[model samples]
Target: MIRWALIFLVVALIAAVLGFGGIAGAAASIAKILFYIFVISLLISVVMILINKSKR
Candidate 1:
């Protein structure tokens, strides 16, 4: 997921450099959404692991 976000970020940069305003904006927004989702899921996984360990 993080990898995908980075890929989209790179695409956005390239698009911006080429003056593709719409494409760059879209890619940047997608990258931002992906990054946030990845972070949230990671946090949830970590919390779950900690809770499970503590339960044992």
Candidate 2:
């Protein structure tokens, strides 16, 4: 997921450089959303790990 977000971020940068405003905007938004999701999932996984450790 983080890889995908980076890919989209690269695409957005390329598109912006080429003057593709709409494509750049869309790609950037997608990248932002994917990044947030990745962060949230990572946080959840960390919390789950901590909880499991505490249960031991």
Candidate 3:
């Protein structure tokens, strides 16, 4: 997931450099959304691990 976000960010940068405003904007937004989702999922996974360890 993080990899995907990075890929999109690179794509956005390349598109922006190539003068593709719409494509750059869309890729940037997608990257942001993916990054947020990845962070949220990582946090949830960490909390789950802690809960499980405490229950042991």
Best by the TM-score measure: 2
Q: What is the lDDT of every predicted structure here?
A: 0.99, 0.99, 0.99
What is the per-residue lDDT of model 3 for residues 1-56, given as tens digits with 9 covering 90 to 100? 89999999999999999999999999999999999999999999999999999999
Q: What's the number of clashes in each of the models?
A: 0, 0, 0
Model 2, span 1-56: residue lDDT tens:
99999999999999999999999999999999999999999999999999999999
Model 2 segments beyond 4 Å from truth? none
Order the candidates by TM-score, highest first — what do you get? 2, 1, 3
lDDT of 1 at 17: 100
TM-score, cand. 2: 0.97
What lDDT is reached at residue 13 by model 3?
100
Local error of candidate 2 at 49, Å? 0.3
Best by lDDT: 2
Error of 3 at 2 (Å): 1.4
Alpha-carbon runs more than 4 Å astray in model 1: none
